[model samples]
Target chain A: MEALLYNLTYGFSVALTLENIFYCFSGVFLGTLIGVLPGVGSLATVAMLLPLTFALPPVSAIIMLAGIYYGSEYGGSTTSILVNLPGEGSSVVTCIEGHPMARQGRAGHALAIAAIGSFFAGCVCTLVVAIFGPLLASVALQFGAPEYFSLMVMALTCASVVGGGSVLKSLAMVTLGLLVGIVGTDVNSGIWRFAFDLWTLADGISVAVVAMGVFGLTEIIKNLGDDEIPPTLLQKKITGLMPRWKDLKQAFAPILRGTAIGACFGPLPGLGGTASSFASYMVEKKVAKDPSRFGNGAIEGVAGPESANNACSQTTFIPMLTLGIPNSGTMALMLSALTIHGIAPGPQVMTSHPDLFWGLIASMWIGNAMLLILNLPLVGVWVRLLKVPYRLLFPVIITMMGIGIYSLNSDPADVFLMAFFGFTGYVVVKCRCSLPPMILGLVLGPLMEENLRRALLISRGDPTVFFTRPISLGFMIATAVLLLMFLAPVYRRARKVAPAEEEG
Target chain B: MRLKIKSTEDFWAGLIFFGIGLYAIYLAWDYPMGSALRMGPGYFPTSLGAILSAFGLAIIALSFRLELENPAHVPWAFRPWLVLCGTLVVYGLMMRFELGFVPSLMTLIIGCSLAHRDVHLLETALLSVFLTAACVGVFIYGLGLPFRLFWWSY
Candidate 1:
C-alpha cells in the first residue's frame, strides 16, 4: 500500500514536468503520425530523433522515446484497419479484422475500440508495473550465464513452436539469424568472426537496417507486383463513433482478459507484441459464445488483441531494464540508447536512478492519455491518409527507410544493406517462411553466445552446470512442456482451426 | 499456378540442413567450456549443435513420412526467386565494381525490375532513378555520413 502511494506520488511529480510532458506529447504525436502511415514506422522516427535527444537529460529522453514506442503501436492500428498494410509487424494481425470492420462501415467503431482499448490497457499495465516492478526486478537479479542461456533457448523455442508455419522453416530462419548475428566482431577475443573483410561489416548489421529492410522496404518490393487497390470507405456516417452499449459489453471482457494475458506473457522473451496478440486471440476464441464470429470482424477480435499488443509493448521493457536483456527490437534500440548515455540498464538502474524509473512509469500514463486525444479526433484524418496513391506513398516509404537507416550512423552502406535484405525478405515471404523467428534469433544470438562462453568458463568444461542451476533447470522444464504442446494432436487441431477462424 | 511438392524436395532440403548441423557439431569439438564465467567457449554450442542436428534429422524423417502443405505456396516460383537472388548477386558484385551509391542502386533497381517483365522499361527506370535519388538525399546527405556523392577519388 505504501509502495503504491509512493509510486503514484513519485510518478505524478516526474511525469508532470513541463519538458517531459511536452516531449511525451510530441513523441506520441509523431509516433501516431508515422504509425498511421503504412510503411513508415515509429522506430525510424524515434531513431531519427535520437540525435536530438542527446542534448536532453537522459530521463526525459528515455521517457519520450518510450512514449513513442507505445504510441506507435496504438496508432499503427489505424493504418492496418483503414489500409491492409501494417505499420509494423505487431499490427499485422489487426489488419485482418480491422480492415474488415472498416469495410463493413464500422471504421469509426474499429478505430474507437482500438484507441480506447489501448489506452485502458496501457494505464492498467502501468499500475501493474508500479506495484509489481520491484518484486520482478528482484527476481531478475538472480540470473547468471546458464540462466540467461536457458531463457534465450526457451524464448527461441517458444517463438518457433508458436510461429504457426512450418516449424522446419522457422528453425532454419533461426539458424540463419544466428549466423548473421555472428557477422560482426566477436567481443571477448576482439577477433572479427565473419566481417567478410568489409570495414562496415566489422560492426555487423544494425537493427534499424534489418527492420527497415525486412518490414519497411521488403514490403514495398513485394507489393509492387500485387495490383490490389487500396480499400474504399464504407460509410460517411460518424454516428455510433463510440462503441454501442452491446459492443462495449462485448469488448470489456476481452480487454480485461487481454490485459491479464498480456501482463503474464509480455515479460517473456520472443512473445512481445505478436505472441501477446496471438495468445489474446486464442483465449478469446476458446471462451467465445460464438467462436464463429472470430475472423468475421468480431468486435472482440479488435479489442482483445489490440489491448494485448499495447500491454505487451510496455511489459517487454522489464527484461531490458531489470536484467539488461532486450527482448524485442525496440527494446534493443532502447538498451543501446541508454548505453550511449553511459547509463547501463540492470537491476541497479532502479536503485541507482529511482527518478528515471518513476518518471518513466508516470509518463506512460500521461502518454496514453495524450495518445487518446491524438488518435480520437484524427480518426478521419488518418482514414484520408489511406487514399494517398501507392506510387506516391511507396516513394515516401522508400525515402523514410533510407533516411531512417542513415540517421543511425550516416552510412550509405547501411542503406545498401537495407536494399539487399529487402530483396531476400521478399523471397522469404514468398517461400512462406516466417520472419519473426529471424528477428528473435538476431536479438538473442549474441547474448546466447556470450552466456554460453561464460558458462563454460565457470564450469571448467563441466556439462552439468546447465542442469544443476535451479532457474535454468526450471526454464528447461518449461521448454520441455512447450515441446509437448507442439507434439500434441490437440495443438495441431488448434493450429488448423486457428487459421481458418482467422480467414474471415 | 500453385505447384505441389511430392515430398522429394522436402527430403533433400532437410538432408542438407541435417548435414550442416552435423558439421556444426563437428566444429564444436575440443573446446572445453567450463561454466560460462570460467574457461572454454565451445561447450554449449557443441551440445546445442548436436541437438540441432538431431532435430534436423527428425524433420527429414517427418518430411519423408508425412505431408503437410499450405495453399499459398508454389512448389517453385521462378519470378520471385530470380528477382530476389538476382538482385542479391548484383548488390554483392557492385562493391567490387566500386560503383557510387547512385549508379549501384540504379543498376540494382533496373536489374531487379527487369526480372518482372510485366513492368515497362520506362516505368522501371524512372522508379529506379527515383529510388536512387531518395537514397542519396536521405541516407547519404541527410545523415551526413562522409561519403562521396560520386565514387571517384577525385
Candidate 2:
C-alpha cells in the first residue's frame, strides 16, 4: 500500500507538470469534441495523431492519448443523450435511456449524471490500476502460450455469447471476422495465406481503416438520407449543468453498483465497453425497485451503465499492458500503435518499461480530471452545435475526417476507402446487423490466432493442450459456462421481455 | 415506409461469405502451415478460414430461418445508395487529380448533392468552399500536417 501510494504520488508529480497537464487537457478536449461529432472516432483520431507523438517522451504522449480515450467514452454519451446519435459506437446503449431522458426534459440531469458517473468510474479504475497493475503484471509473467490460447478462447466465447442476440448470428459474425483477420501474409512461413493478391490485403486490413470506414463512414452515409427528423424537435434550454440533489441521491447507488461491477468485469478478457454496459444495465434492472422505468429515462439507468462502460474501458489496459493482449477494438488499435513504437504489450512491458506502463495508468486519473473540467463548462458550447445546419455540418465533418485519414500515411486511397466504408456501413446498419461483433472479430481474431498457434507450437501441435493446463482449463470452463449461461432458456426469456421504440 | 427486407438476401449474403471463406481455406491448404512439430504458420489461417466457412453456412441457414418467419424484417433502406456511391467516386477521382483538400472536397460534396434532384448548386458550392478553407486551416495548417498547399507540389 505504501509503495502504491508513493507510485501514485510520483505519478501525480509527473502528471502535474504544465506540459503534461496541457497535453492531458488537449487530449481530453479533443476526445470530447470527436465524441460529440459522429463519424470521427477517437481510434482514428489517435491513430492519425500518433506520428505527432513520435517526438515526445513516451509518458507525455501516452498520457495525452489515454486522456483522449477516456474523454471520448464519456463525451460520446453527451451526444447520445442530447441527440439520439452516439458519437462513438461504444455509447450505443447510452442512447437507450439517455435520449429518452432528454426527450422527457431531463437532458441536464442525464448529462450531469453521465459526467459524474464517468468521473467516479475513472477514479475507481485509477485506484484499481494503482493497486492491481503490478500484481497483475507479476502473475502475467507466468503466462505462456497455452494460457494465452485459453484466454483467447474464453474471450471468443464471451464475445459470441454476449453479442446481444442469437448465439448463431454472433458466432457467424465472429468467425467471419476471424477469417478476414487472417488475410495477411503468414509470419512463420514466407507464404501468404488469404491475401486476394492485393498489396493492401497482403498487409491485411487496418482495424482503424475498417472501423472508421464501416462505423464512422457508414454513419455519415446514413445521416445523408435521414437528415431531417421532424424539424419540430424540442430544443431544451438545459438550464444549469449541475445534477439536482435528488437526482444525485438517486445516482449514488447506481454509481457504487456500477463501480463494483465495473472493477470486477473491467479486468476480464473479452468483455468490451459494450458488454460492460449491458451487464451493468441487466444487473441494475434486477436490483432496482421499478424495472419498468428502465427504458423510460430512469436516472439510475443513466448512471450505472455509463460508469460500468468507463471502468471496462480503463481497466481493459490491465490485460493489454500486463499481457500484451488487447481485449477490445479500441485497445487493439492502441496495441497496434505501441507495436509501431517497438513495444509488444504484456508482462515484460511493465518490467522493461515501468515508466510507460505506470505513466499511462497514472495519466488516466489526470485525464479524467481533465475531462471533467473540460466537459462541464464546455457543455454549453457542444449543445450549441445542435443548431448547425446539416449541410454546413457535413462539410466540416467531412473535412476533419479527410484530413485525419489522409494524414495517416498521406495515402489518398485511405480517404476513398473511408468514404466507401461509410456507404457500406450505412447499408449494414440499415440491415440491422450489429457492427460491434464484426469489429470485435476483426480486432481480436488475429491476436487470438497468434496466441493459439504459439500455444500449439509449444505443445507440439497438440490442440488439447488448451484444456490440459490448470489455468487454461479454468478459462475454458469459464468460457463454456458463459456460453451455457447465455444460451440457457432463462437468459433468453429475460432478454425477450420488451421492445424499445425510437424517437424520430 | 421501411423497405421490406429481401426475401432471400440474408441467406445469400451468408452463403457468399461462406464460399469465400472456404475458397481461401482451400488455397491455404498448400501453404505448408506449421504443424505441432514445427509450428507451420499457415495452419491457423487454414483452420480459421475453414471454421469461418462452416459458420457462414450456419449463419445463412439461420438468416433464412429468420426471413421465413419475419418477412417484414428483410433489410430496408431510406436513402438512395447511388448518392453515397457517387460521393465516394468523386472523392477518388478528385484524389487522382491531386486536387488539394478543399477543391476535391467541394466537388465531392456538390456531386453528392447531385444525387437528389432538389440540389441548389450555388448553396452547395458555398458550403463546400467554406468547409474546405476551415479544414485546410484547422486540420492541415493548424495541426501542422505536411499537406501540399498546391495540388501539384509532388
Candidate 3:
C-alpha cells in the first residue's frame, strides 16, 4: 500500500511537469475536437497525429495520445446528446436517451450528468489500472514462448469473433494482414521475403501508413460516398448546465454499476467501450423501476452508458500496457507509437520505464479532469465547430494526411502507399469485412511468429510441447472454447435456415 | 445447373483473399524451408501462406452456404476515390521532383476539393491558400521541419 502511494506520488511528480501537462492538455483538446466531428473518429485522428509525436519524449508523446483517446469518449457523447447522431460507435447508446433529453429541453442536464459520470468513472478506472496493471504485468512475466503464442492465438480468435461480421471473413482478413505484416526482410535470415525488389519494402510497411490508409483515407472516402441527408443540429439554446441534486443522486448508482461493468469488459480482447456501453445500457434498463422511462430522456440511461464507455476506453489500455497485445486498432496504433520510440512494450515496460507507465496513469486522471472542464463551460465552442461544412473540412483533413505521411520519411512514396491502402481499405469495407482483426493480425503477426519459432526450437521441433505445457495448454483450450462459442450459433442458424430454404 | 453465389460481397472478398493467399504461398515457396526446430526464413511465411489459403477457401465456401439479408448496395464513390488517390500520387511525384511544399500542398488541397460535386473554384482556391499558409506556418515555422517552402535556393 505504501509503495503504491509512493509510486503514485512519483507518477504525479512526472506528470506535473509543465511540458507533460501541456502535451496532455493538447491531446485532450485535439481528441475532443475531432471526436465531435461526425465523419472523423479517434482511431483516424491518432493515426494522423502519430508523426507529430515522433520528436517528443516517449512519455510526453504517449501521454498526449492517451489523452486523445478517452477525451474523444467525452466528446462523442456531446454530439449524441445534441445532434442525435453518434460521433463515435460507443456513444450510439447515449443517443437512445440523450437526444430525447435534448428534445425535452434538458440537453444541459443530460450533458452535465454524462460529463460527471464519465469523470467519476475515469477516476475509478484510473485506480483500477494503477492497482491491476502491475499485477497483470507480473503474471505476464511468467509466460514462456509457447504460452505467449497460445495467448496470441486466443487473442486473435477473440478479436475475429467479436469484431462483428462473418467469422470466416474476419479470419481471412486477419490472414491477409499477417501476410502484409511479413512483407519485409526476415529477421532470422538476411533474405528478403516479400520486398519485391523495392528498397522501401526492405524496411516493411509502416503501421502509420496502414492506419492512415485504412482509417483516415477510408473515412474520408466513406463520408464522401454517403449520400444521406446531414443531420440537423439542435437549434434550442442549452441552459441549466448543472444537474439538480435529485438528478445527481439518481445518476450515482448507474454510474457505479457502469464503471464496474466497463472495467470488467475493457481488459478483455475485442470487447471495448462499445460492448461495455451496450451492456451498461441493458443493465440500467433491467434495474430501472420504470423501464419505459428509458429512451425517453432518462438521466440514468445517459449517465450509465457514458460512464461505462469512458471506463471501458480507459481499461482497454491494460492489455496493451501489461501484455503488449493490442485488442483493437487504436491500441495497435498506441503500441506502434511506443515501438517507434524504441520502447518495447510488455512486462519489462514497468520495471524498465516506471515513469512512463505510472506517469501515464496519473496523466489520465488529469486528462479526464481537463476534459470535464473543456466539455462543460466550453461546450458552446464545440457546437459552433459542428457547422464547418464537410467540403471545407475534408480538404484540410486530406492536406494534413498527405503532409503527415510525407513527413514520416520525406518520401512521397509513403503517401502513395497510404493511397493504395486507402483504396484497398475501401474495397475491403465494401466486402463487409471488419478492419480491426486485420490490424490486430498485422501488429501481432511478427511477434506471434517469433514466439512460435522460439517455442518450437526450445522443444526440438516437438509440436506437442504446446499441449504439454500447462499454461500453453490452458490458452489453447481457451482459444478452442472461444472459437466454439462463436461457431456454434452460426452453425445452428445456418442449419435452421438451410432446412427452411429446402422447404421453400 | 449454374452455381450461383449466395453472397456477392462474400464471394468477391473470398476471391480477393484466396488470390492473395495463393500469391503469398507462391512467393514463399522459393525461400529455403528448414525443419521445424531450426526454422529457416521461409518456414513461418510458408506456414502462414498455407493457413491463409485455408481461411480464404473457408470463406469462399461460407459465401455459398450463408444467405445475406438485403445485400448492401454500396454505391462506389469512384470520383472521390480516384481524385483523393490521385491528389496523393501527384503530391508525391511533385515532392520527389523538388516542386516545393507550397505547390504540392496547393495541388493536394485543390485536387481533393474537386472530389465534391458542388465545388466553388474561388472558395476552393481561397481554402487552398489559407490551408497552405497554415501548414507552412505550423509544420515549418512552428515545428521547424525540414521542408522547402518554395522552389528557391535559400
Candidate 4:
C-alpha cells in the first residue's frame, strides 16, 4: 500500500505537467465531442486521431488516448439519452432507459445519473487497475506459450459465445480475420505469404486503416442508405440537470452492483465493457421489485449499466497493460499504440516502465474527474451538436479519415485498403455476422500462432503437452465451461431463445 | 438477373467464407509444412485455412437445414457501393499522382457526398473548404505533417 501511494505520487508528478494535462483534457473533450455525434464511435475516433499522437511524447499520447477512451463513455450516453441512437455499442443499453427518460421530462435526471454513476465507477475501476495490474503481471510472468495460447483460445471462444450472433458465422469471421492477419510476409521465414506480388502488402495492413474502414466508413455507408432521418427524442424540456435525492438513493445500490459486475468482467479475456453492461442490466432487472419498469424510464436502468460500462472500459486496461493481450478491438488498437511507441506491453511493462504504468493509472483518475466536469454542465452543448445533419457531417468525417490514413505512411494504398475493409464490414454487417470476433481474431491470431508453434516446438510436437500443463489445462477447462454454459441455455429453452447481442 | 437464394444471408455468408478459405488454403499449399515439432511458415496458415473451409461448409449446411419458405430478399444497394468505393479509388489515384492534399481531399468529400442524393452542392463545397482548412491547420500546421497543400511546384 505504501509503495502504491509512492508510485501514484510519482505518477501524478509526471501526469500533472502542463503539457500532459492539456493533452488529457483535449483527448477527453474531443472524445466527448465524437461520442455526441451519432455515427462516430470511440474506436474509430481513436484510430483517426492516432496519427496526431505520433508527434507527442509516448506518455502524453497514451494519457490523452486513454482519456478519450473513458471520456467517450460519458459522451456516448448523452446521445443515447437525447436521441435514441447510441453513439457506440456499450451505450445501446443506455438507450433503452435513457431515451424513455428523455421522452418523459426526465432527460436531465438520466444524464445526471449517468454522469455521476460513471464518475463513481471510473474511480473504483481505476483503483482496481492499480491494485490488480501488478499482481496480474506477476501471474502472467509464469505464462508459457501453452498458457498464453490457451488463454487466447478461452478469450476467443468466450467472446464468440457471448458475442450474441450465429456461432457458425462468428467462427467463420474469426477464421477469415486470422487469414487476413497473416497476409503479410511471414515473420519466421522471409517469404511473402499473401502479398500477391504487391510491395505494400509485405508490410501488412495497418490497424488504424482496418478500424477506420470497418467502423467509420461502414457506418457512413449504412447511414447514407438509411433514408429516414432519426427523430430527436429530446422533445421534452430538460427541467433540471440534477437528480432528486430520492432518485439518487434509488440509484446507489444499482451503481454498486454495476461496479462490481464491471470490475469482475473487465479483466477477463473475452468479456469487456459491452458484455458487462448487458450483464449488469440483467442483474438490475432481476433484483428490481418492478422488473417491468426496466425497458421504460427506470433510473436504476440508466445508473447500473452506465456505471458498469465505465467500470468495464477502465478494467480493459488491466489485461492490455499486464498480459499485453487485448480482449476487444478498442484494446487491440491501444496495444497497437503501445507498439508504435516501441514499448512492448506485458509483465515487463510494469517493471521496465514504472512511470508509464503508474502515470497512466494516475492520469485515468484525473481524466475521469475532467470528464465529469465536461459532461454534466456542458450536456446541452453536445445535444446541440446532434442538430448537424448526416450529409454535412459525413463529408467532413470521410475527409478526416482520408487525411488520417494518408498521414500514417503517406501511402495511398492504405486508403484503398481501408475502403476495402469498409465494404467488407458493410457486407458482413448486412449478413448479421458480428465483426468483434473477426477483429479479435485479426488482432490475436498471429500472437496465438506464434505461441502455439513455440509451445509445440518446446514439447517436441506433443499436442498433449497443452493438457498436461496445469495453467494451460485450467484455461482449456475454463474455455470448455464457458462453451457449455452458453450452449446449455439454448438447449434448456429450445423454443424461447434470447441470445445477448453486441456490436464492437 | 441475379441468382436468388432461399437463405440469402446464410448462402452469401457461406459462399464468401468458403471462397476466402479455399483461396487461403491454395496460397499456403506450396509452402513447407513441417511436423508440429518443427513447424514451418505454412503450417499454421494451412490448418487455419482448413478450419475456415470446414466452418464455411457447416454454415452452408445450416442454410439448408434452416431453409425458409419465403426466401429473404437481398437488398444489395449497388449505388452506394459504387459511389462510396469509387470515391476512395479516385482519391488513391490522385494521391499516387502527387496531386497534393487539398485537391485529393476535395475529391473525396465531393465524390462521396454524391453517393446520397440529399447533399446540397453549395453546402458540400462549403464543407470541403472548411474541412481542408481545418486539416491544414491541425494536421499540417499544428502536427507538422510534411504534406503540401496544393503542390504549387507542379
Q: Give me the candidate number with maximum TM-score.
A: 3
Interface RMSD of each: 5.0, 3.1, 1.0, 1.4
Q: Report the first chain's TM-score for all candidates.
A: 0.86, 0.84, 0.96, 0.94
Decide which is better by DockQ, 2 or 4: 4
For model 2, the local distance difference test gives 0.69
TM-score of 2: 0.86
Tens-digit lDDT string for candidate 2 (A119-197):
8999889888778888988887888888987876777667566545445555666676777677788676656667667
Task: Give lDDT tens digits, candidate 4, residues B1-154.
Answer: 5444557688778878888888888999888888999888899889889889888888887786664444345466666767887899899889888888889888888899898767688988888888888887887788787877776744
For model 1, the docking class works out as incorrect
Angstrom error at residue A285, model 3? 1.0
Choose 2 or 3, whichever is better by TM-score: 3
- What's the alpha carbon RMSD for model 2? 4.5
User: Candidate 2 chain B: worst 10 consecutive residues by lDDT?
Assistant: B68-77
Residue pairs with colliding backbones in model 4 are none
Per-residue C-alpha lDDT of model 3 across residues A1-504, encoded as one tens digit per residue: 897899899999999999999999999998898788775667777877777777789999999999888777677789889887675567778999999999888999999999999999999999999999999999999998999999998888887766556777878888787788888988988888898988888988989999889888988888889884466776546787887999999999999999999999888887767778878998999999999998899999999989998898888899999999988888998998999899998888999999999999999999999999999999999888877788888898888888888888998779889989998898998887888778788888789889989999999999998999999999999989978877697764643332110000
lDDT for each residue of candidate 2 in B52-113, tens digit (9 for 90 to 100): 78867776766643543342453343444566556666676676667766667677666655
Instruction: Label model 4 with its docking quality class.
Output: medium
lDDT of the structure predicted as candidate 1: 0.69
lDDT string for model 1 (A1-504, tens) is: 997788778878988989899988877876776666655455544444444454468888889788777777777788787767776556777886788887777878888888888889999898877777778788877788888888877867776776566666666767766655656666665555445578998887765567567765555565565554666656655445666788788899999998888878777755667667877888888999899877878888889999998888777777777776665546766765676577967777888888888889899999999988888786777767667655545544444444355545655577668767776677666655566566657766777787777776687767688899999999899989988887899997776544311000
Name the best candidate (by DockQ).
3
| lDDT at B54, model 3 | 84
Deviation from native of the Cα of residue A296 in model 3, angstroms: 1.7
